[model samples]
Target: MDKKKFPVLIKYCFLKGKNTVKAKTWLDAEFPDTARGKSTIKHSYTKLRCGEMNTEGGEHSGRPKEVVTDENIKKIHKMIATECVHHIIDEYLGMRKLCAKWVPHKLTFDQQ
Candidate 1:
């Protein structure tokens, strides 16, 4: 109820009363809401901080460009080029046949 008590309340809530003088001074200067009243502050802070509201021009917001090094491009090319020889042969032969030592198959078909 008393004006002096307001500072004490803020000091108790924000800084644990270690520096009540500084806490009261900061609170008065900033006019910050009580911690209990921070739901509105939180929404505003998040919108402004994340540039969702577009109030600050969002100098730090956007999708970053994908980073592709030479090795990464080479790896991607190799991945696209990779193929299962058995799958290719089966597609063309119309049968499941082993054409090479590396082509996998059931143990019964290991002969061919």
Candidate 2:
């Protein structure tokens, strides 16, 4: 690559001091200014309704004194980002509906 292209390539690579690069940072680095400007998000609609998610990474350790571990926070982050809870709820609800429709209700156990 030419000297002029080195910086552009590096910028596209998302080199944030080291291998530790946030997904947002990587996206911003890869996308152009115009593209980034156009990528607007509506929190009311885009935000997934999940109350179990916590941003603080200091709640993972079992100890009552030690701050939360990084891995625990990462697990939550992955869960929220992938919307795993939503999928799980969807599956459970569908199964429940199917069960309600197919299964018959009985007031007396004599039929069993």
Top model number, TM-score: 1
lDDT of each: 0.47, 0.40
Q: What is the C-alpha RMSD of each candidate to the true structure, in Å?
A: 13.7, 17.9
Minimal lDDT window, size 10, model 2: 37-46
Report the C-alpha lDDT of model 2 over 1-112, residue by residue, as the tens digit. Answer: 2333433333333333322234235535655452222122112112222332222223465666645789888988888866765555545443222444532233248645
lDDT of 2: 0.40
The list of candidate 1 runs beyond 4 A from truth reads 1-66, 83-112
Error of 1 at 54 (Å): 25
**lDDT of each residue in 1-112, candidate 1, tens digit only:** 3343443344343434334345445555656454223343344444444644333223566655665778879988776565555546666544564463343344455555
CA error at residue 13 for candidate 1, angstroms? 11
Q: Kindly report which residue stretches of model 2 are placed more than 4 angstroms away from their true locations once superposed.
A: 1-62, 81-84, 89-112
For each candidate in turn, the TM-score is 0.23, 0.18
